[model samples]
Target chain A: MIDWSSFAYLAAAVLFILGIKGLGSAKTAGTGNVLAATGMLLAIVATLYLTRVVQLELILGGIVIGALIGSLLAKKIEMTAMPEMVALLNGFGGAASALVGISEYLSRQGETTGGMVSIAIVLSLLIGSLTFTGSLIAFGKLQGLLSSQPVTYPAQQVVNALILSAGLGLGVLLATSPFSELYLVLLLSVALLLGILAVLPIGGGDMPVVISLLNSYSGLAACATGFVLGNAGLVISGSLVGASGLILTKQMCEGMNRSLLNVLFSAFGKHVESKGADTANKTARSFTPEDAAIIFSNAETCVMVPGYGLAVAQAQHAAQELATVLEERGVKVSYAIHPVAGRMPGHMNVLLAEANVPYEQLVEMDDINPEFPETDVALVIGANDVVNPSARTDEDSPIYGMPLLDVDFARNVFVIKRSMNPGFAGVQNPLFFNENTMMIFGDAKNVLLELVTSIKES
Target chain B: MLDDPAVALTILVLALFVGVEIISKVPTLLHTPLMSGSNAISGITIVGALLAAGGEERNLAAWLGFVAIILATINVVGGFAVTHRMLAMFKGKEQR
Candidate 1:
């Protein structure tokens, strides 16, 4: 029966891999998710059936309670809050990994442990503890409970290095003395503290990278626990997730034109007052939604660039409506997505998808940049940094070399913003002052609604 | 199922390359779902949790395992559900 269940796990692992393969295309992504869920069901059932030798009630109770809470959370969270929700869940996954390591260690205390087993346990505990707290801090910053700015102190990196060294030293101690659970507890504390300090200096705008990195950590923690348990399914799935996360983290950094080290250490966007007053003196032509509608009506082709502000204002549906109206009026409409446009990679796509925006119309940054010059009107909504021209020209500017959406090259540009205040990086956008740019000052949703109305009327 | 640590290490390493190869091609359109889906899969640690909690010992191991099961279950369930919801909204023109 154990052998039979092992075969089931092997089959489950194959299905999990196929599930991720299904995500390769939008067409099959739904089926892939279902396949993965089926694999999960199989794995869980195999575990339960392998050991009917005892505590059924506790297992059932835990699943029921967990299912209720999990489903409720999934049902209740808004699409705009998805990033933070994912961050929070990642934290729990890491915690579970650490708990498994501890449980396994306590269960096997009477037996002599192998060197490999001891190393796996300590590594799992260390990675799990760090991931748990690191993800929590990410959630806090994303949810606005903590300051979104990079919180840095003198010699922050040096302190972080010393703490990590101390945690590794504790790992050595814990590994040598497996019976001393005290070493385990001390190592866990060091790791949790390390998670906080590691994430502390990362500004909120850089959360895409942090979240992706923590996502990787959670997976590696699971992998370490797999080694402790001698389970191939856990190891396989954990490595897949770890790889997926590392890839996404790299993607996010490339989107911002920064290295992983720079993202982690430099605390980019540390100051908010970097010549922001330049925007006040520079001429930004302000226009009303009605006036903006006239130019949009004349446009033959339009590109919509959305940002995190659009999510904050909950205007995706309105933006969709505006695009629909434009399409109805014989104007071709497509959305130009900046890779790091919203709070996370592909955030704009999620928000837009939620509003039933056609997936084909969401163009990638590299794919859409060349089309801007040929485009008639480009509408910038609730976005700033991704579309800024300074990333191309201003050498001294922090965002000097990052790729932009190139919305400035369009025949006409309409920027829907609340004020002339600088972006998250506190860099003034030359695109805002472009002769072709019209800054429409208002709340994003309100301005979008007004645009939809006036476009309908026109 | 191999009990050898070397076997597990080999599996982990091979899976890392396979994982990277499989996911490297995912288009940005579904990146959110890709992330959420992979996150849910990380809850595979639940197998170990079940083993520790399965015995009627009701000791420290059982309690910790019970707690671990619940937390991992949240990740597995919440992650998949959220991802499904997000994916459902991503309509292509053909679907509409």
Candidate 2:
């Protein structure tokens, strides 16, 4: 019945692939968005043309409303809220897939055979439901509505395993029978619950991995739905997402020195007994802004590492001012941007860019990691995890495998944190307790401003 | 003249996807978010695949459908695993 819809679908698929490729590089990322959006538009139009049962008015109205809501939210959201926004978008995707699956199931209720159709229905229902709930949990954690602590209980892993086993058993049962909608519903509910259970125990530090994993789940669900529909475009595109998401997840796991299973099962953010308190007491050195300025005034080269605290204090401009003042004093200043710096991905870069920091001065983690060893002064601005020495020296630390900025190797390290508290990973930073390190306790913005003034005076 | 609608639609979707992939790298700021956001777009393909396999009446089609479903399931599971891992890296000290 659909005459030319296939051609349109093919075109859309090509665009989707191109969009993803473009997304890999920073230079052409915006154009990639336009291209992807265009592909989506083409696909939506083709789908509308091909569909026989769905009403045009309803579909168009829904699109308009969704677009408006998304645009409005995007316009108003702050950078700090980006992670939650991402989580919310993921939830929306899961909900959409679930709704579509239900619609398909309802439409073909009488004509559909039980066996494979049942599997499709159950898979869609289960994955979609889990993605929905897991995304919401991630959103709540990122938005601070829920406690960021790893909510753990005795036998937590055992309970999670049981839940998964029960859910899988139910899915298998539903897949084998056509009249097992009740079992399907139960499986869906259990999967949703399992998703919540899985993510709830993970600490805030693990949210990025959770979000990425949820993203992958959402894509695979889409692919399953595509299989149910026999849509080639769905298969290809879904596979692309699933593959890329997995690779990114693997990269993230490597970034944190964690295994996929450890991430899934480990209860992160538990307060370790104060094993390093005495060590902290032995080498803790506090410094004033004036003291920091004195050290900076004489430094030949300074590397400034900014973190989420800088964003929270909105201190990018102040930091830049301090950098400029140092440069004026013949200090070769540059910013070290850890790939995973800030609350959201690239949070530091966005802030620095907003503050008019030059792109040339922003060095990535890999390039800058070794430079720290040759630097005269390493000025850390509210950064934590990226500079943690445990990532290098401590095998038992959760972040032990992730690459770190070699700030610990600098001749003099001045860490500007608000307090002596451990980072989100809930591990003590041995860097804070190092002989060359001096902790400056104050708001990042105010402290940077003071440093700028002191540098100017000197 | 009657043309095969399925074949035409397939070509169009593929083209659109290729175009998107080519253009996705335009904005440096958008690379991560777009990659993240497009995950939703990829999910939409599941609906079409499911319907196609469900509509097939043959044994071969059914087996193909089964394989597709399983592969799709693996993608979903593995993808979510990856996304969560990426997000966890940002949960460093300042965020905590």
Candidate 3:
């Protein structure tokens, strides 16, 4: 029977592998998700069968309650809030692992824990507690429950380091003497505090890195839990998550052209003020909806650039409608997507896809930059920092050295913004003051609707 | 199953390699789904949670185990469901 259960776990592991492989492409991603869910189901059933000493009623009730809440949240959550939802779920995973570690320790009150199990318990508590609190901070920032800006104070690094060291010291002490519940409690508290302080100084602009790193931490916690419980299924899945999340984090950091260490330590967007009072003095050429429509109607090639503003305004559908209308009129339209255009990595792509925009129309920054020069009109809809020319020329700009869309290279540029406000990075865009640039000030969805109507009427 | 730690560690190391290799070739557009999907996979801790919770005693261990089971289940269910919702939105040019 034990052999049979191991086989079931192994089969489930293979399914998980295939599911991940399927997620590599857009067409098969849905199937990949289903496959992974099936793998989860199999693992759960097998574990239940293997562990027969427990009450069936409790497990069923827990599953029913959890599934109800989870599915409801999944159904109700907007796509814009997907990253926050993911962060919260990652936190739950960490909390689960941490609890399992504590429960295991508590259950074995008198038995002398082996050296390996002791190490596993310490690691599980450390990583799990940190992941839980860190992910909560990430979720808070993403959902606007807390300030999105990096929260830093004097000696923040020193304070965080001291907390982390204290946690480690307690971990070592608990490992040497396994029955010290008080030491365990202290270690968990220090780890929890460390997690909060660790993420508090990370600015919202580097949220992708923070989220991914927390996701990785959750996996490491689970892997440690596996070691504590001697569970093969947990070990395999946990390590897979840990590695993939780290890789994803590295990829996002590279997309922003920043190192992981810098993203973790340096508080980005802190130097840039969010207020627009200083930039309001600069004159910006504003255009009415009709004027913007006329330019759009006459353009031979138009490139659309999207940013967080699009998400804020929920104008992705309108943007798609405008693109479709332009395409119907034989106007060539392509979308230029910045790597970090939205809150999370690939956020813009998800929004565009949700709007039913054809994937082929969305071009990456590197591929679209060279084409901008030939574009007749650069339609910047609710975007700022990624298109700002300061990244290229301004040495002291907060966004300096970050790659940007070359919208300024276009023959004519139309920027749809609510005001002359600086972007999240706190940098004023010089492209707005360029001779060819015209700002259409209004709500993104309203402006897009007007543009669509004008194009249709034309 | 608890006979040897080496076997579990071997599986851990191998899965890590496979995970990094598989995700290396994923396109930029699929990054979100991939993140969500792998996140769902990490919810496999649900199995561990169930085993912990179902054990014979109504002690502190059982209570903590119950909480673990619920949280892990949410991670699994929500992660997978949301990933599906997001993936369903990605359409090709022809499909659109």
Candidate 4:
């Protein structure tokens, strides 16, 4: 029976591998998710039927409570809040793994525990505590509960290193003397502090990397827990998650022209004086939704550029509505998505997807840049940094040399924004003052909705 | 089970490669779902949580185990649920 269950675990692991492999394409993504879920269920059932008789009530009670709350959260979370939700849930997972380590240590009170098990317990406590606190900090930053400014003390790097070293030293001590309960407590405390310190210096713009890295840590924590139990399945899945998180972290760092170390240490998005050309004498031309609508009605080709402002205004649905109205009037519309346009990687894609915007219509920056000159109108919605042309022309600009959408190359441009404020990077945008540009300043959702109505009436 | 550290290490290394290989091929468009999906897999630690909670004696360990079970369960249930919800919303050019 034990052998059979182990075989089932092996099969479940393969299913997980296949599932993730299938996620590489749009056509197979839905099936990939389902396959992974099925693997989870199978693994759970097999674990229940193992030789160790699980207490029926406790197991059922835990599952029921978890499922109820989990389902509620899944159903109620807005798409804009997905990053925060993922961070929060990852924290819970990390905490659970740490608790398992503690519980296992306590359970083996008088027994002569294996050296391997003792070492695994200590490592689990370190990584799990780190993941829990780090993920919580990431969640807070994403949710606007904590300041996006990098909060740091004097010699911050030194303090972080000391805390980390102390935690590892305690791990070594606990491994040598497994019965020393106080060592375990001290180790957990130090590791928790390490997590907070490690993440506190990361500013709002660097959240994607921090979140991805914490996700990797959570997987490592679980892998350590698997070591404590000598479970092959846990080790496999945990390592997989760890690697995937690292890859995503690397991708996010590259997209924003920030290195992993830079993201971890920098306090971005805080107040910074602009270094670009001063436009004190310049003024932006303003237009109403109705005027923008008339212009849109005459355009043959339109491109939508979405940014974090789009998410903040929850304008994805309205943007989609406007696109449909324009498409019906014989205007060709496509969306231009900058890799880092929103809060996270692929943020714009996810928002547009939530609005049922067809994936085929979403053109990435490189693919759409060449088409801008031929385009009749480019709609800039709640976006700034991605469309800012200063990145190409102004050498003194903070965001110079960063790749951007060539929206200014279009024959006509209309921007839906709140004011003449600079973007998150605090760089003034030259595109807004271009001769062909008109700012339809308002909440993105309201303006898009009005544009849809106005365009239809025209 | 405790005697096979080499086997466990081998599985860990192999899984790490498989993960990097498969995910590196995944397009940027599916990155969000990929993160959330891998998150659900991380809940595999729930197996250990189950054994600890269901063990004999109502000791401190058992109570802690109960809490562990709850958290891991939430990770598994919530991660998969949210991933599914998100994936269902991703439509192709013709579907919409």
Candidate 5:
């Protein structure tokens, strides 16, 4: 038998720990990435050393092909699609763990203490299946293949609750019974169905939380598979992933001014058709591009807030161009990024960064919120939820308690949207109707380009 | 002694806390790149599964190994493809 590669594995695990630590701080994130890559390299090499019956040709080929594909992907994908990318990666991890569990189960069917191994295998299978299906649904929504609006039926919450309970009940039975394989398959099917049903009713507004929660589930499945395989490293790394995913999910919940249970059960803001009607009825003043350009052209300082609509219109470059012109005319320009802006977390940052916006100019919600009142203009692009006044003024608003941009306090506010339609959360934005706010109803890219020209002509 | 489930559980719990705390503190600016980078790390599980499956001589083990290798490979390849497409969204455009 090959010697255990314990020392190398330990070193790799340490590297992972350090990498994760480094990732927390922006300044050291690059270093953390390097460390994690090194750890992975070390782990792979050590595993090779421990393999007595190695198929060198196959392994080498796989590595080369995987590396080439990975590098190409890294070079090409746009930042706006990062959330879908993340969801896809989570699915990949789940698939990997599940496959490993299944292989181990099949190999050791007769020899192992069947109870524990079977339990681990079943758990892995269930969680992995759920993660895979749930993540795909999230990807479809984020990519706009599926409707972003919540698909709700009467008694939807009750139906979901029953499904969840039944899935859990089946999981428990699979764990205890001797006829484990039959129950295992049942559990997997139930979990898959549960995943689809769980995410189906979730509105676009709650997708970030769904994605985070699914990520956690994938990690836990990996951890269980690690136990079954008797791999310490897998268990550790998997648990780390699972735990972090849960915490991130919680943070997302808090960011949306929601509780975890409420997100899961209440399906908050899933069908706010009535709320949309209320917002439409509110009389809001409008401004032509020319009239808005005059205010923008004269402003001493301006802060632009880009949202999902801006991305949908592919207007970041246009916005950047407008900012450049405004700056040349002596206006201080910056971008405010809410933590939960866009579909996924940090959605606006990725979009702005793509447009070559400087990292320093991308201010956080807290940093820029206080500065809005003193600013000359707060230009909102394809953004609604992050700027909604309901977070502060209306306690009954579904988005109440969520922190928001203080654009309402600005001397002048320009909102660029297709219409007065409610945002992802399906809530009316009172700011649109404010006297200081002017609606610029058009595609963000076209409107921004028009404003740039009008500013130049004036 | 090291195989004790309790020890495993403790390690799992501690690792998770540390990991979550670290990821949560990452600034908004780095969230995208970091997520993409870490995805590569997750892919390493493929290598582990490969070793476990191929090295064993038994029939069950060999087939298990084969399946593991195939699935893991798909996961790894597909993950990179999607990530690359996502990162491409950031090209061009310089701020003044």
Candidate 6:
């Protein structure tokens, strides 16, 4: 006999690898998802049959209840809310790992636990608790339940450092004396508080990095749990997540020209208001919808740049509508995507994808920056900082040295914004006051609708 | 039978390499799906949760196990469903 249960887990591990490979491409991502889910099903089934730990009725009930809630949330959540949803799931993964560690400890009940086992339990508990609470704070920021700006006060770093040192002391004490559950409880509580304190100082603009880091923490928690459980499948999948998430976090930080340490510790976005005072002398030229339409009618090529504003206005469909109109008029249309645009990585891509914009029409910043000079109009919608020339020209600007789209290079630029307000980065845009740039003030959806109408009439 | 730390460590080290290698060349557009997909995989803790829940008899261990099972199940099921929903929305240049 093949001992099908062990074989099933081996098979599941292979499927997970295949699933991750599939997800690397946009084309195969759906199939990749299915493969991973099939693997999960296999692993779950194998565990249920082989362990026979709890009654089948209890297992079935838990699965049914969990799956029902999961399905409802999956179907109901808007695509724009995907980042927070991922954060919430990451939190749950952490909680599961910690809970399993706790249960295992209670079950052991002084079974002569070795030093290695003690170390694994403490690691699982520490990482899991931190990930759980850290992810919740991330979810709160993304979902608007908490302030998206970095929350800091005097001596914040000193206070956090003290808490972390105390946490480590407790962790060490628990590992050395496994029978004393008091240290374990204290460690868990301190870890929870530490997670909250660590994430609270990071602003919403750095959310993608925060989310990725939390996802990695959850994986590391699971990996520690695997060590305690002596399970190969958990070890493999957990490390895979841990490595991939850390890489993604690094990539996002590099995209913003920021170091990971700076993003986590320094209050990056909170210093924007002080920088806003410099914009007082700058004045932007205002244009009407008809004027924008006239310019678009004569344009040979136009690139639309979207940001959080497009998402806030729910104007992705209108953006697509504008693109279609311009294309019908023999004008070429494409999108310029900033990596950190909107609340998360690839947020604008998701919004445009939702509106059914063809994938080829969406261009990354590096590929499209050179295309700007030849372009007739760079239509900036609800975006300010990413297109600001200050990133390259002004040395004292907070966004200095960050790579930005050269939207000002276009022959004519039309910026659609709600007001003269500075962007999320709190820096005033010198590009807004550039002679080539024209500002159209209104909600992006309304302005885009007018642009589509006037272009059609022309 | 797989209790050897050396064995588990080997798998962990290898899986980390495979993870980085597999995700090396993704376009910026797919980053969200990448995050969600990896999230679903992390839910593998459900295996440990199931063992904890069923391995004990009407004790604190059993209750902790049950809660772990519920949380892990949500991560697996919800993570996959959300990833699929987002991936399905991505259209190629040829699509209408």
- Deviating ranges (above 4 Å) for candidate 4: A110-114, A393-395, B2-4
lDDT of each: 0.89, 0.66, 0.84, 0.85, 0.72, 0.86
lDDT of 4 by residue, A150-267 (tens): 8977888888878878888888887777477788789889988888888888888788888788888888888999889887888888898999889989988776767788778766
Candidates 5 and 6: which is better by DockQ?
Answer: 6
Candidate 6 wrong stretches, greater than 4 Å: A1-4, A52-54, A274-280
iRMSD, per candidate, in listed order = 1.2, 10.5, 1.4, 1.2, 3.9, 1.4
Please provide TM-scores, in order, for all candidate models, with all chains considered together: 0.97, 0.82, 0.95, 0.95, 0.89, 0.97
Choose 1 or 5, whichever is better by TM-score: 1
Q: Ten-residue segment with the worst summed lDDT in candidate 2 chain B? A: B84-93
Predicted structure 4, TM vs. truth: 0.95
Weakest ten-residue segment in model 5 chain A by summed lDDT: A272-281
Residues A176-217, model 6: lDDT tens digits: 764777876888899999999999999988999999899998
* C-alpha RMSD values across all candidates: 1.6, 8.0, 2.3, 2.0, 3.4, 1.7
| Best-performing candidate as measured by DockQ | 1
Clashes of each: 0, 112, 1, 0, 12, 3
Chain B TM-scores, listed for every candidate in order, come to 0.92, 0.47, 0.89, 0.92, 0.61, 0.90
lDDT by residue (A140-238, candidate 5, tens digit) is 887799987777789887887798788878877755655556765677778888778888777767887887787677778767876676667767766
Q: Chain A in model 2: its TM-score?
A: 0.92
In model 6, what are the clashing residue pairs, if there are any?
A53-B54, A53-B55, A54-B54
In candidate 5 the C-alpha lDDT for residue A14 amounts to: 82
Span of ten consecutive residues with least summed lDDT in model 1 chain A: A272-281
DockQ of 1: 0.79
Q: For residues A1-458, write the lDDT of model 1, one tens digit per residue.
A: 33676777778889889999999998899999999999999999988886443778778888888889889999999888888988998999999999999888887786765477888899899999899999999999999999988889998888899999999998988877748878878998999999999998999989999998999999999999888877788888899999999999999999989999999999888876665224555798999999988998999999999999898898899999999999999999999998897776677899999899999999999999999999999999989989888788778788878889999899999999999788888888888888999999999999999998999998
lDDT of 5 at A149: 72
Q: Ranking under lDDT, best-scoring first?
A: 1, 6, 4, 3, 5, 2
